[model samples]
Target: MMPPVARAQAQVLPGMGDGEMTASAERQLGDTIARQIFRDNDFLDDPVLVEYIQDIWQKLLAAARLRGELTPELDERFAWTILLGRDRDINAFALPGGYMGVNTGLIAVVGSRDEMATVLGHELSHITQRHISRILSRDARNMPLMVAAMVLGMLAAAKSNSRSGSDVGQAVMMGGQAAAMQNQLNFSRDMEREADRIGFGVMTQAGYAPQGAAAMFEKLQYASRLNDNGSYPYLRSHPLTTERIADMQGRAQLKPGADAAMPLVMDHAMIASRARVLSRPGVDVLRVWVQAAGTTEFAKGSPAQQAGMLYAAALSANELKDYGVARDMAARLRERTAGNAPAARLARLLAAEIELSAGQPARAGALLDAKARDRPEMMLSAQAAIAARNPAPMVGPLRDWVATHPRDATVWRTLGMLYTAQDEPLRAIRADAEANVAILDYVAARDRFKAAQDLMRRPGAGPVDHYEASIIDTRSREVDILVREQHAEEKKAQR
Candidate 1:
């Protein structure tokens, strides 16, 4: 029982419901927004940190698929990507499709892996439920207004120079549309509740503690309070309420796993400590934090946590070329985590990084080799290989790593850097194209691919030849199609 305008907004379009946005048009829309997001924000592209985040996302995704919360076919189509925003705000968001972003502040603020999983699960639910598309459909009659707001947002983003705390001028069409906007807000709150209900289930079903949702919200509540009287960026978008916290707590209390005392599979303390170290840009800032952590109050936390913090401090010191502090602390970390299998591996990775940073590639390579003793680890061994030498000692390992992690834009970028240093311009151009493609930067990717194609056909005594030309030609045409489609969808959205 709604008026014409509201009814037009509520009516679902063909192929836009069931929380599934698998249509080709939706996919293109997602890519466009993701491109804008990356272009306007400072993103943390550290391989190790990104790997950890991807691991948690994969776990939640597996659980959701197992429960039939998501179909395997739809899963394959979603192109689920988790990216890190360099902003200090304790916020995370789900974009148009399956694209999700977490700020460094949110990751550093979390106390446990389960809490992180809860956030990921919640965001995943938002996508799976298709709340965003539904909102657009319900308000389809307001498309012109929405488009205008988006334009203003883009202008604002440009004016702010893509800095942290930029508002993006979204929702600028408010004065005359207050009543409609209020209804929209109410609808959004309902979506939030639904996401919470399903995301909570997603967390526990994945063999994680259900209490984590409550714990994280408790932290979020305090953070919101401290942020200019509860005006945290997440609150502005998510609108946290006392009811939501109580609901999470009530549900958590009923969790059997919490009563049974389920232990965490991941070393959350170490993970959070790593997040904290990488959150700050400089070694000096980490050194100050590490020094303060040794004080009585912080020292009382836990030995594992303390070891993690020291490991972070040591890694930072290594970046500052303080080899003495880095070597000693890294050695101590290995000793402290000797009994913990996973923790020991993390410490060793830290060791490899320290040695590599100090220009001791041999020592770094030897440490990882000793761990396997004979067999090698695809995960860490390949990473160590990349850090070993310029021109890269083991191209095999890098290729293997990229094959396994095809969606990792950072790794593709690293591969490109390696090829460039080796004076392999053609390969470097292709690698850069793949990196851009992974991030859905179609225009950039297409141009790079085209450049490589042109080089392949150039009449010169160079690396690229006829066979390479054929390969490049094929890739060029494929990417050209994508670019054409991308532009078409972009034009449609604007119109």
Candidate 2:
């Protein structure tokens, strides 16, 4: 028999596992399975994907703080990824290791950031409780059964295998399998109940109305009933029941002494605006919703409701590319409320974006630079500065920011990209290397290193002897390991 580590490595591919494996063997097997799952799915190694993941993660992280569920320790391992699915199904899922994916369809359905945060918080709880890891570990004891369950679970996850990495069909298939897994899979009913109970707690703690989760589930249930069965993967995998709704209501009511004085955090407007930016049809529709909200029974019902309506309108206009109108509305909002950070930040960012889009890069640079200085730790402002035409000057500020905020891989990646843009290949390579380490993924880091070497080999490029040799040496070692793994697999198959 192979040693635990070797046996684990051998079982890296999907549907292949070491039955009754030791802890080390199980971990190796899990890593192998994860690698195969990612590889077979045609995952892209693009910066845009990385940026999108980082953006969503940051937003959720902030939401976690508002709910008081996030601590420094939790923040370190709480990473997420957004998978763009082509499916029309409104769904999302979170893996045990902080991997949460939001379908484009789900993005369409969510009317506000608060609602999305409700979803994210619920999923985050699953990871925080180590549900996925526990499930996987249990599966390792029964290899065949685990494989079958995983196939179903992955289906529930909405897996895809597309070159563009955005195929909804793949995800739908995965989601379907996941639903099936619930029936025959090994996870206990107690686990589901606990997840529901804890997820509701996280959502309310994040300052969201605990009712949002119940409302969302109700909506999903209604939608599912309206269509044939299995229309929504999320509902299918989650399996909403009357009991689940009652459970949530019970949990929500349990917190009678909850902070009633807590301010209602409004993120709907931003969500509506972002949806508009990403969806052309959604822009006009959201704009109408925003406009109707002002005078409708909804806005006239209450002061808080009216404020939310106005905010949504301003956000809609911003999404429609009506910057001047958006700015005016934002200013009005700032006047209405003394401490409207969202309104102020949105206005500032919109103004900068407008300048950049209008080909006034220098003006954008100045605005962003000043903002970055004022909010020295603001990632968005730092990113805006990095996007400026001559980001060379901003590099020093970015480096300083990174020193203080070392966990932000996006900043490191941005610095590396900026260095490359400025023809500083060596710096770019080093920055990218650091970013990769922060991510704890060698495959990505090795690719960035190769890019740096290629840049150094250009004509009149700086002395590349050391960097070039280093790249070759590092990359060769990585490639050797891959080759060895393939050889071992082949030998095993032959036997």
Instruction: State every prediction's TM-score relative to the real structure.
Output: 0.81, 0.62
Estimate every model's Cα lDDT from 0 to 1.
0.67, 0.53
How well does model 1 score by local distance difference test? 0.67
Give the per-residue lDDT digits (tens) of candidate 1, residues 341-445: 878877888887787778776787777752342112333444555555444654455656677777667667766767776777887888788888887787898
Q: Which residue pairs show backbone clashes in model 1?
A: 9-138, 9-139, 10-138, 19-129
Q: Model 1, residue 240: displacement in angstroms?
A: 3.4
Summing lDDT over every window of 10 consecutive residues in candidate 1, give the lowest-scoring window.
1-10
- Please identify model 2 stretches exceeding 4 Å from their true place: 1-89, 103-118, 128-130, 133-188, 201-232, 257-264, 275-339, 362-388, 400-409, 432-444, 450-495
- The top-ranked prediction according to lDDT is 1
User: Measured by TM-score, how close is model 2 to the native structure?
Assistant: 0.62
